[model samples]
Target: MTPRADPLTVEVVELIGTVVARYYEEYEHAAAEHSLTGAQARVLRLLAHEPMPMRRIAASLKCEPSNVTGIVDRLESRGLVERRPDPADRRVKLAAPTEAGRATAQRLRDSLDFAREPLGELSVAERALLKELLQRMLGMTPE
Candidate 1:
């Protein structure tokens, strides 16, 4: 004997999956338009805030270290990112976004207007409710 999910639960899960799939499609398109792969764009965006070590980047990206190395290699070749020695630990390498990388990341983010197009149709209150629900689903406190 096995427990079965409620019909409403399944429907909600499917809807969420559909929304995420569409979002990724739009996001990847934006990245491609900027002459960057999704992974490279993701790395540049992550480094926009602060420098991070290669291992930490791998953890954040949820990928193998080797994969991150190749991504970084490509980004570095484009002069989008640069690797520097961690000040505290000479053996560790940190990746920092260059000025060009920041600009490219910003452009990609600005170009991804998929959610904005649909959300624009909602009332302010509806948008607020949607944001609250999304935050709750992500296990984040409403700000």
Candidate 2:
């Protein structure tokens, strides 16, 4: 048996979905300006932090390994990423962003401010409260 959500809960969930979708759309447009697709830009962003295996990237992006291969291939051809054998396991390959990739990723991040502009309208205390509430909703402990 399914339990129905309260009206307030439903409204909240719908608003969250709408906000997330809008953010993605804005991000995609920003990425396009850099000659990268949303998926490719996401891969660059992920690799900007550290090297990761194709499997892990696929898992993070909720896509298949084969799809990741193509994305990685494109990034690599553009000198945006490099693949090297994992230090822990020589058989496993890890992908890391190149210098150009890192620069592009940073640019992409700096260019996207859909949330930043609106969030800036809130006071510091309000922003903090919103962050805390969002963390709680995501089941994350405050640092």
Candidate 3:
């Protein structure tokens, strides 16, 4: 049922997978340094941008809402995240990062040596091109 990809396409897919795996590996290591799991750190990072409802977070994380509840519970206990009734819908709860949580997220981003070192090697134009190419590959934006 699957169509074969060209050799170049297959190789590119494999390389992307390898790069993603290594990035996650490095991310987990960085997360451990802060006494957090990758998932916890990820939730913090997401909340650092803006609050999100439990269902939306579950959808984004590709997990069940119950799973997100547990993650939120843990984060809440750590004083990193708080649950408040959604202003848009009183029946729903939103998870938001505290000031401490935002600071931790920033620190985690700052400590990502894996991302900084190699990407820093590229010129600004090269980085822009790479970003454009990756965004295109993911269909994230219009050309």
Candidate 4:
């Protein structure tokens, strides 16, 4: 026998799911304006931040390495990113964004301005409070 999730828990989960879905949808729409798919844009953004192993990217994307292979291939074909053999371990490969990729990511981020309006509604104090609460919920320490 297993206990059922409480109604409140279920509702919260559904709400979170809805919010995430909406967020992604909005992101996709914004990315489309720049002639980029959501996944491609995401890859560029990730690479801009740090070089990562393909396996690590696959794990983070919750997909198989083979699936990530296509994404990498497409980006590489566009000259947006490149894979290089890790100096420490030749067997490992790391993915990094090219200058073009970084520029594109920056442009996309600047164009989206996703939270500009919504965030504008909050005062500085209110924004700080919201940030603190969200960080706690996400199990992150506030800086």
Candidate of highest lDDT: 2
Q: Candidate 4 at 53: error in angstroms?
A: 0.7
Model 1, poorest ten-residue lDDT window? 1-10
Q: Is candidate 1 or candidate 2 better by TM-score?
A: 2
TM for candidate 1 is 0.87
- How many clashes in each structure? 0, 0, 0, 0
Please report, in order, the local distance difference test score of every candidate based on alpha carbons: 0.90, 0.95, 0.89, 0.83
The better-scoring model by TM-score among 2 and 4 is 2
Query: What is the C-alpha lDDT profile of model 2 across 17-136, one tens digit per residue?
Result: 999999999999999999999999999999999999999999999999999999999999999999999999999999999999999999999998999999999999999999999999
Q: Which digits, one per residue and each the tens of the lDDT, describe model 1 over residues 1-143?
A: 22236787778889989999999898888899999888888899899989999888899999999999999999999999999999999899999999998888888888989998999999999999999999998999976
- Write down the TM-score for model 3: 0.92
Between prediction 1 and prediction 4, the one with superior TM-score is: 1
Candidate 1, pairs of clashing residues: none
Overall local distance difference test of candidate 1? 0.90
Q: After superposition, how far is residue 127 of candidate 1 from its true place, in Å?
A: 2.8
TM-score for every candidate vs. truth? 0.87, 0.92, 0.92, 0.82
Which digits, one per residue and each the tens of the lDDT, describe model 4 over residues 15-114?
7788778778878987788678898788777888988888888888788888778888998998889999888898999988889888888988887654
User: Candidate 4: lDDT of 141?
Assistant: 100
Off by over 4 Å in 3: 1-4
Candidate 1 residue 81 C-alpha distance from true site, Å: 0.4
The CA lDDT at 84 in model 4 is: 93
